[model samples]
Target: MIGAPMETKGLNANRESKPNRSRKEIIEKKKAMDALLKAASAEKDHLSAFPAFRRYQTNGLSAFLESGRGDKLASSVKHYIQNLLKANMEGLYGSEWPVEERVKRREMVAPEARYIFVREASNASASEMSTMSEQESTSASCVEKRGPMVGFVHFRFVIEEELPVLYVYELQLEPHVQGKGLGKFLMQLIELIARKNQMGAVVLTVHRSNSVAMNFYLSKMRYGLRRVMKFFAKHSVMRLKLSWRYVSVSTRNHLRRFIWFNKVVNSTLFTKGQNPAIEVLEWIIQFQQNALIIVI
Candidate 1:
């Protein structure tokens, strides 16, 4: 799945009529894709000690989780969804989650900001999506052991606005399925989701220090860096967009406006730390004053 995009990109790049593609650019892109493919096959090393997604069972208000790692990615994901629904409902019917809770909930449960990959597998012997409902799928299947219980992802909407623009919420693989280029294959699965859904983009946020993730997103997948924030865990927001490649004039202008707003807001917000630029100039002057250490 993850490997699918590399193949597609290679073909697309080949057919492109652009005359200014530098030899260096082509080499770099190929190298990046190769690395992505390799990582897609890695049996697991520096990555999270275990699987990226898992499952959980709840008894009343208390929830029990099971994940490859202690973090219980699946349980966390479920809780996250609950939080969003809570937020949405609270908005209309006298809230419960306060501001702090809202932020915490977002950190726990929001759909990924960016996703380099996604996979949408229908039940091999399927019914039409519209005719079947969420409950029907859950009731029909025995909680697909081949992959994570992707009940939420399988739901359909007539519009893209209803879904997260960009995200890679989870990556689940069975042991035998581990490595051997399946990750890339899974990513292609996601790409189809983004493209077919008519999403303007796909995005994922990773810890700033998560070099492997950052490399996969920015280098291999060609997702653009969108935001860098110090949210408890510093993270880089990245996006895969079809817009920048061929956006409308109005859209481009709106982006220009956003850039202007960002500059003004960020300049004001980043004004702390005593102006290092001024501090540097002061230090230079101080050095000049001390240079003529004459006893006059």
Candidate 2:
């Protein structure tokens, strides 16, 4: 009888400690996330850690990279991002563009947004500025003689699914710069940034109608689809006429806003000491993968 009481007391003690332990774990996790974010944001230049990747000169294209924040971007650059994204993606959305544009405008200026801009390079030391009036008064040591902006990548380090990740919001390039391997190079750089920051993976969303971009990502970039589903199905927006047939208005609209979530292949899949970007490129030749697509 005495031993039974002691065992019952011990069971009660464990039952009482479980909640405390769980609570402690939650608190520790939150602290770790905050610390990781703080460390990443504290760095002035993520690219500085990889100098070789700062300049991409290959396949008849020459460009250098510079970093900026959306909120700190010069007015001209903001206009440029708006114009470039519209030129590249407007047709894919059709009637949903105006609303999508509004959303993009707001998102572009969020404080957390980070940008990596590609500028034309004339030589290793300097860039040749173009006619665009996007000149910003930055320190000479940071950026010098920045050339015409040919492309830009917008990404953020965020916690997703309880794991830290770098989410690519936009990867826009001027039409002239397309097909020159710049996009693939930018994605590779993005993956490196994710890895350097200790992120679990890299994530991005794409439009289903943009088949060329879709193929480029899956067939060339080796980004795997993480999920596919409907988003904002209950929400309605103004409708417009279209020449296409065989689909209801809501379905058409939903399809118009369909989003695909693409994630870099899990890092663990790669062998140790091998370059992840190169490995990803090698994987592309053998498979056609599907990325996550969401209907919004």
> Which candidate number would show the highest lDDT if scored against the true structure?
2
Please give the range of 10 consecutive residues that has the lowest summed lDDT in model 2. Answer: 239-248
Model 2 alpha-carbon drift over 4 Å, by segment: 1-7, 122-144, 231-259, 264-296
Tens digits of lDDT, candidate 1, 1-296: 99999999998888774544555655654465344334433322111232232112112111111212112246755464454445333442244335534553443433322222122333441323334433443333523412322222211111111122324433433333333444444454445544443332343334344354456555555544433222223222222221111111211111211110000001111112233422322333445421111010
Provide the overall lDDT of each model, using Cα atoms, as 2-decimal numbers. Answer: 0.32, 0.67
Give me the candidate number with maximum TM-score.
2
Q: Per-residue lDDT for 1-296 in model 2, tens only?
A: 99999999999999989988988976887688777777876667777776667777677777778788867889999999999989987898888889888888888898778889998764533433222222321336335654678889998877654456788889999988899999998888888888787765677777877888778877897666423333356432321131111211222234444444546444442332233332432344235432332222
How many clashing residue pairs appear in each of the predictions shown?
Answer: 23, 4
